[model samples]
Target: MSQKILMVDDEADLSKLVAHHLQKEGFEPLCVSNGSDALKALAKQPFSLVILDIMMPGEDGLQVCRKLRNKEETASIPILFLTAKDEESDKVVGLELGADDYVTKPFSPKELMARVKALLRRTERKESASSYAYRDLVMDVPRHEVSASENRVTLTAKEFALLEHLLKNKGKVLTRDHLLNTVWGYDYFGTTRTVDVHVRRLREKIPLLTDAIETVPSLGYKLVDEE
Candidate 1:
């Protein structure tokens, strides 16, 4: 199937032009003029990615992004911010809030399409790599299976996602909020205690890596190299 993209922009002409270009590139583009409409579209039909304008009539793109990120079902869907602001801080805010990518105003169709492809490609690779791991700690994402040292470890969907997120960021400290936003998909309104619960459960299943994951105490958790 062709890649499905949802585009939210207040500018009618720009939205049309972008939709046309994306269609030509073998992508299925669905354009909406406002955030509410974009949400409506998503509720009615699902898409692989969303291209949102930061400013709009009723609900702004940032609000929509936040809402989507907070929802469990739609949170993992890739989000790309399309806006006129060019400040570095603005870009950081969007990414920090869970926007996977951003495109400035007056962007080239070719360049915009490139960003789209890159995000999609990276998501695909991550999905594939987990299943294709060379280590005995095997992860069958699609099948929801994990094995350490050739021993099977049962895990819930959330547990697996949390582990995948950490393992993918191995050797890095993942803040509690970051994990909540990324793994739980902005939908979880729970406290940091939620992360702790899952992490402990995950450790119980894979006891061999108990020391590999460290608690930040009053902060977050990190997966590090074992001695």
Candidate 2:
């Protein structure tokens, strides 16, 4: 099946033109006129990517992106924001809202298509990995499964994220603030205790990892003895 892409914009003619181009490129385009309809469309379809315009009648692209990211099912959906707003802050806010990319108004069709293809390629790469491993420890991200010593382990999103971070940087000592910001996001600050909670839970899940990950006391943690 061709990859499905959602286009959310109140500009009917512009969306239709883009949809025509997208369909020509072998994507199934679903067009929505407002944020509510966009959310509804997402709830009903498994779109490969979303092209969202910031200026819409109802809720805007920012709100839609933020809400979609909050929902577990749609959290990883690739979003490319289109806007007439040209300020640097607008782009920054869109990115912080979890938009995968942004395009300003008057963007060339060729450039837009290139960005769309690039975003989808990146998303496909991530989905292809979906899982990471070190030794007997496995983190199946899409399935949200973690295991060690040939047994399944249950972990919270935070705990699994922490473990994934450590395993990815197996031999490095990641600072508390770095882990906190990366996994929990920069919106969460001052409560460094959250990192400790996740680390403790991760250790509980993989007891053998107890020694693999060493606490630097007041500093952070490191995964050594890597496989």
Q: How far is 87's C-alpha from truth in model 1 (Å)?
A: 1.1
Q: Which stretches of candidate 1 lie over 4 Å from their true place?
A: 125-140, 143-222
Candidate 1 positional error at 103, Å: 1.1
| Candidate 2 TM-score, true structure as reference | 0.63
Weakest lDDT window of 10 consecutive positions for candidate 2? 185-194
Q: Provide the RMSD of all predictions against the true structure, rounded to 1 decimal.
A: 9.4, 8.7
TM-score of each: 0.63, 0.63
Write down the lDDT of every candidate, Cα atoms only: 0.76, 0.77
Residue 149's lDDT in candidate 1: 91
lDDT of 2 by residue, 1-227 (tens): 89999999999989998899898899899998999999999998798899999988779888898898778678767788888997877876775566656789987777777778876654442455457778788888777767787787755344556677787787888999988677655543224655665576566658877788899878999998554
